[model samples]
Target: MTARLDSVEPAVRDPIRIDFEGWSIEARAGETVAATLTAHGIRGLRATRTGADRGVFCGMGVCQDCLVEVDGVPNQRACMTSIDRPLRVRRQRHGQALAAEVTALPPATAESLRTERPDVLVIGAGPGGLSAAIAARRAGAAVVVVDERRYPGGQYFKPLAVDGEDVAPPDAQHREGLALVRRALEAGVEIRTGVMVWGAFAPAEFTASDDRGAVRYLPKAAIVATGAYERGWPVPGWQLPGVMTTGAAQTLWRTARRLPGRRVLIAGNGPLNLQLAAELLAGGAEVAAVVESARPGARHLGALVAMAAAAPSLVRDGIRYHWQRMTRGVPMIDGMVVAAIERTAEGLAVTLKNASENGGHRRFEVDALCIGYGFEPSNELLRALGCRHDFDAEQNRLVTRRDGDGRTSVAGVYALGDCTAMGGARVAAADGAVAGYAAAAELGLPLAPALEREREAAKKQGDRHRRFQRALWTLYRAPPYRIEQASDDTIICRCEEVCFGDARAALAEGVIAAGPLKRATRIGMGPCQGRYCRPLLEALLAQGSDRQPDEHSGFAPRVPVKPIAIRDLASASD
Candidate 1:
């Protein structure tokens, strides 16, 4: 029921048949293995070591939950691996040994490493990273932007279809990204999409890899705008197939034009859930219910006024989303949260409990469950590069300590977008431009007076968006996060399958910080590098200690923040 609003309906071009689990499935060129599987109702992609069913939880490459076997190569992330030809994809099961398979694989080669010297290195192709690159390039710096995503727009500016070359962008976000990316390219910015920036040794020393091999970047200055991932809530059966973050569902729908299921139950805190619900409904998917943790009402009139003042179009968009929900007869279950989820023959049986004044529980049998509880910044590279950070008690996450112009504590290094703070795309774009101009000025690059004037405008735009973000959150404010509500048996780490009880026992044994607790219980030892569980672990610690976790409570940023092939890592050595 979920697909692009293009010729995808009638038929597609250059289609290929994939032998997935002995069933021949139709797929499109450039379509992700995850999308191809889900389009035909193939949910259970793999099994956890504990025999628990898993699917596309994070959607992006952050979570390794969607690993599958691709042509005998076990543990390939279906979401990250795209196929343009015929292939065999198998479900990776529990206790499936890769030792023999590993030996069968090809070895690493030094030729995989390509050294590049650039004036500015932007570690993301998203709004912020592209903006920085564009500005730096225009100011006479040789800029190279690297992003892990196949498309250059990053998550917010995600392209409409996997094979949408003939199709126009479905929305204004993609259009905007297209325009910005075009401007960056015109300004001589070297954008290397499909490249994963894995490690940062020095301020501007970075190692990245692609399908072919690895590349080492030595830039004079660097901007770490790796962006953020969807924050997760650890509910029971959350790891089940068809249960995923709102962003993951959006990615599938937007990029691959595939819905997780025919009917979806969208839940959790923040405006994203609402926006996603509207998008899915527009895409012809039946929304079972929009379970929101917040109850926006007239009591937040001041915030509404500020939001309208800051971004009237966005406010109107929010209204439009609600109007669509109403017109579509979609249930907008506000002041509630997904309490539990269980598998059903038809789909998933979801239980919604009241988190606010709406004191009631509702049940729904839906094909999929989309849960997005805001986001956590992907600041591993920034932190790894020794940029300072602080715990924002209000937001309940760690934020990068940076100047107004995006200057980090380390010289020649910058940060922008939600990676620094969870401001929206508008905020990121505006702030990125300012940082770019600042970087240019610092590098002694010639900045025309017109560009300086535009920089001032960018600063103003950033201010307005910041104000809008504040007011928007106020309008969508939810109750405090209660990690204790999660059952003791709830799995906290999807990678390691560590449960709440395990962490509780570890805390009982005198481990309070993330590092010690991670070792004691092996919680954050997952492939995601604690991007999903770090906040939960800190919350768990706070619940037990009766105090909030400090900035240090999050795991220390390590080398190869994202999972890199051993071959790619070895090739990084000059």
Candidate 2:
């Protein structure tokens, strides 16, 4: 069993008791139902179809692994739902809600759906969307900002739990994000939180839902800053209870104010892993080790030199992170990858193998494993809107077409932030400012001279950030052979329980692309809508056939980017 920190106090003064799987537990007000469960070391929130225990893998609403039946509603995202009153909660199995008390409980009627006709609608509340909304509002355009998370911060600026001690220390990036959000609100931007945007009709029409039923926003322009999700890689035992993505682990500490486990292993191929190690150390969790698949060599030298001359602050930040890890006695191992994982008698056992040399492996035992190779932009909304996109080979992803000012292929639509490419916070903010100014100007709002100057300056700053992004991609790019490390028996898609062996067999039987492979082996047909497995599976198929990722094509996403309550859909009006 996992242990939780009893020393830390709950954020709320007033608390309520709730029933969890027949066991009553104390929960604080303003705490997410998911956080309440984690604080008590309840990891197995649900069980899969194969009888495997599943818990909070992404913590965010993106991964449906944390679904729980709340008040008789089936398939509710526990991480997004807050505890307002005494509620009956039960663990879900497959798609079944197992609460015995739920006998013909009717859906709670919500208030009339709020409709808005803002001049400009910002799709995300992170640095990008906030900056865009601020700029647009300053130029006299009525603006509204919407985000899926309850908080205003996007992933990078995600707000920490309200604890006595600061969950996150004073950082420039966090400060900037907060300042942007404040300025946008002061500038009269209407901010909507905890809204899930399901569908987008071209030319600025969106169908979304919140606790208040369904809402539609008919804006003259829209800016998409919906950011990216942590990329998932397949390996044996990845479906186990203790396994989670790197972002999920960070969310555990940052949002829930609790460590994921007593002992944890961090593995991935990016700078985020280094930062996560430092974070874990601060959160009072034992860092077993950090395994980095990318090896530092001459290829990264040019990018490093360019960044040093262009953005010394970014370079210094990286140095300071490593220094913190070194002082804490955390081992930073490079040129290594997680070859396989399995549940042992003690806990989760991970096999670390050399990325450069085959047949070399080392074993480590830990209670939890946090793994992420990189990030894939949440481009489903843009794709579903029919925005033109082309593949970027070096980045190993597809980016929505946008000019320097965040204009997309479709008119009245703009794409910004990491979704455009992983350019971090500063770059996203700069680009967002430019987009906001340009959008306002296009909408017939007269921009002041100072705002115009700021727009130009923002463009120049965005260039520097883009340079840093280029260096970042060059420095920690995933090796081609890393995907080949998955054993034949490894489960690739946890949603459908599709194994790597079955996918390989389908490829061997002349399945050339993702479309054919899906039909042959049911790879991408699952509850997650291929959010977790499609990218890795597509890469594997491409590598097996020696074709590029774009040649294999991408998965077509359907409406409702996230899973919604059936009652909410029924309540939505045309």
Candidate 3:
């Protein structure tokens, strides 16, 4: 029996009685307490540290924007949580409740920041987002830019300290990004650092939560340039503390000035792996070996051609660096893969397997193993919003619809940078500029001819990059051996302590599907909310049960769908 979408109507039922801040309300069953209160016109669910009013911003779970107390727990994101049964809500000022007690600080941390509504809310402050913000502000729209990182640079341009002073240097493509962000800041863009817009919903509401406390923003239009994360191949001991993805290692080194380990083993097939090896070696870390899964002669031939033709200087520099490494006795091993890893007191004992040989392996002592196949779009926010997505089997990511401009299927909501499609920073910054100009035009702002021409040029670059990306995806697709890496004892969901054996048992006992397995074992319902574990679990189940990965396995759908504070729910009916 297939569920008919057209048969369901939007109606409230099975009311649950609750009290919020002295007000009595009847919340329908299966409705979030926040949704019930909002329906009853109850605003100001929680108070700021300065005793100011606040409410939901991002409707999704990531932002932690709609945090409130339900029953007794404090600091829960209201949007991600549901209001089943009965919930008590209370108003918690910045320094009034447990949050205050936890920090035991003056109100300055909570009260000193100014709050204002902007006409345009940009979810990321990357190159594309910054360019869009600057254009909007220049056209007389009050603009606010929010980013999860401490600094404004997306992946392309990073902030560095020179002579003990913070400075931003423009990489090959980030130079233009730096100029755009500087222009926006100069033009009065209200930039919020370390703020993540986790959820966006109808009626123009969004939620954001940070160390400063939860804040909600209402904007006329919003742009999503949230970018992407590195995709790690599933393998044994991947969850080990010393095993990090290439991007994670890069972030640690570049942002925090911390090395993941003294001796590193770089594995995985991609140009990025080579780039990371170079960076790690340059940063004074010992590179034990560079193991590439691809047969270099066959896979990198086209890339070599592209490198020589498009970026000869980069090619020369890469050759020179590799030569220096060889001169220093560093070895680059091809046609090899990391078979497994064992944690030792020293660090990690990694097993290396020859790709061409059967049952051939060697063990190497290493402090860290950095692995990443490539990049994938961060689509958690988009998926939560009911946006249509298709699985790009090659890249292992959800695909979004886009036109010449960066418009997604949802009008007034746009995606740019690697989040839309994977390319390096140069393409991302260029796409950001195009999205900015298009968004500005839609907002009734005039666009300069030169900017329009620049956008046209960017499209050409994007096309070329897309072709290159496609070739890379086909060449370095996850090998069949990856599916066999899951041992029976390998933990599937770290948050819930669910393991491969547990999931298999559930399947054998007629749990049968992903949804049922999740319900029986609570595998995907942990605090991370399945972001980190869902894909891997889905893949494993698909392989084990002979089912499609996208098929509903049997996870229960819960309201607020995320962790929420008990106090805010209690306040709504007070």
List lDDT for all candidates, in order. 0.82, 0.78, 0.60
Angstrom error at residue 190, model 3: 3.1
Model 1, residue pairs in steric clash: none
Score candidate 2 by TM-score against the native: 0.90
Report model 3's TM-score to 2 decimal places.
0.72
Over all chains combined, what TM-score does candidate 1 have? 0.93
lDDT of 3: 0.60
Clashes of each: 0, 0, 53
- Residues 1-574, candidate 2: write the lDDT tens digits: 0101221123444567889988999876656788788777787887778877887787677778888888877687787777768889988777565354343334432234456788999998888888898899989999988888776778886565444443444346556656666677678888888788888776667888876777778888899999998877677777777778888777766655667787889998888888878778887888999899988778778989988877898799888888988898888888888877888876789998887777679888998899878888888888878788778876778878888788998898988998877788888899999999989998998889999999999999999888887887778866744568677888888778888889889878887677778888888787678887787777776674566665227577677766665556556432
lDDT of 3 at 287: 88
Selected candidate, larger lDDT, 1 vs 2: 1
List RMSD in Å for every model shown. 3.9, 5.0, 15.2
Best by TM-score: 1
Give a tens-digit lDDT track for model 3, residues 202-245.
54456655545555676666677777766545556655546666
lDDT of 3 at 312: 62
- Angstrom error of the Cα, residue 225, model 2: value is 0.6
lDDT order of candidates, best first?
1, 2, 3
TM-score of each: 0.93, 0.90, 0.72
